[model samples]
Target: MAPGKLVLATHNPGKVVELAELLGPHGLEVVSAGSLGLPEPDETETTFIGNARLKALAAATASGLPAISDDSGLCVDGLGGAPGIYSARWAGPGKDFAVAMARVNDELGDKSRTAHFICALCVAWPDGHSEVVEGRVDGTLVWPPRGGNGFGYDPMFLMDGQAQTYGEMTRAEKEADNHRARAFRQLVALLPARPA
Candidate 1:
């Protein structure tokens, strides 16, 4: 069956709002996992797809509704992807992106700042059906964080050709090229259109 107003397994306001804005236009009513009272599950998986699928499947089973979940993090080439799936906990809870970004830079220290923001999204149905899609945006991580338009590592994440970091870009611009949006588009592509 086609998806009918599925829940996105996340409570992040920024993430949820953006997904809502993007999916709303397509007539896909997006619901947050918080709205459905589903708790965040432990991301014991090693890969982005594993974590994303874990949350999506858990939410789908808990709510009995189709669910989608995304896991994304900065993967620094020089640091050998030090923070891959551990981006959030890099700073040790409190979800401190500042400290996390700093640690990432320190780890790279004088080396190349080349990195990519990878997003993995998974959609799951209560009947045990699931699909995963992923996207990435290559960029350089700067020493001092810049811009106030975005949260997390946005201030430090500078796109190759762009002069500004993700935080420096306007919301519309970030939404257009963000890893999550990129992955979401791919997930949408894999989805079958509504039935007549």
Candidate 2:
């Protein structure tokens, strides 16, 4: 086949940029599902795999193009994985990640403060081919949040073994050590090599 041109199922540009970096040197043409006017999946699935696949398959089938999608969330140890799939809508629509983060801080309030960021990456091909990978970066949650870099849970997540929180870290630092990037690297490694 021709060099792969992937359509990321999500409309989020931040994720689109991150995905491009993770995809690497093959220089594959990356497109967004929003460009195709595709509606985002309902995300009705209970698990990350289900949600990620829903988006990837929908975009791939709609555009007749290979597609990539991610379903990621912050899981709090005390909450027993609550707000997992609902992380995006925890504070209701219009996606107030800031509010959501605050809510988490409030809910956990004075307990064993452990948390993790989980990422599910799904790739779907027009011919119905597909793949899914998962990655997690475990850490403890902090109160009042910190830093000003990352969006959504970044301010509170003290990445494992690191002194600075995710929000405190730069974009490059986040990508190099983030859950999404780890899972993406696995998926990218699986991409077929281009013809010379």
Candidate 3:
């Protein structure tokens, strides 16, 4: 796994930036599938790892290069981990989290606000060989979403024992110990070591 070109199998601008940042220190060149004009495949998988594997393999096969992909979502305890795989769908076609967050609140009513953000990272090679891992950070929901730094449900997620929401924290603060970073830490072993 020498440092080299890698395709990120996602069209999400925020994810592309975040993942690129994470992959930077490894000396790997990162490019989004969307940037490469690769089509997004339907995520028919029921689990995060499954979907991540699907996207990674698709990109790897199409681009004939190593590819990475992640499937992440906010799972609420009260909602029985609903919006789990359908978090994006909950945002509708426009990918509006404001509406999605509102829906979460409405459907939750007075139920527990406990929630967790989970991420599954997958790396696939052109031959279809792959490795996947998952990570999560627990937190609680807050109304009147705060901050505007991160995307999706960040504004509504307050990590355990933290004063600021993920959206309120600086990029360094948010990336320091979030779900994606946690997953990346585990996936790092599969990557080339940082250049000396």
Which candidate's TM-score is highest? 3
- Looking at candidate 2, the ten consecutive residues that score lowest on lDDT are 187-196
Question: Which candidate tops lDDT?
Answer: 3
- List the candidates' TM-scores in order: 0.93, 0.93, 0.96
How much lDDT does each candidate structure score? 0.85, 0.83, 0.93
Shift of residue 26 alpha carbon in model 2, Å? 2.6
- The per-candidate count of clashes, in order, stands at 0, 0, 0
Kindly list the per-residue Cα lDDT of model 1 for residues 106-177, writing each as its tens digit.
878788889989999998888778889999999999878988886667889997788889988998989887
Least accurate stretch of 10 residues (summed lDDT) in model 3?
187-196
Q: Evaluate model 2: give its TM-score.
A: 0.93
For lDDT, candidate 1 versus 3, the one ahead is: 3
Which residue runs of candidate 3 sit more than 4 Å off their true CA positions? 190-196
> Model 1: how far is 55 from its true place, Å?
0.5
Candidate 2 residues lying further than 4 Å off, grouped into runs, are 193-196
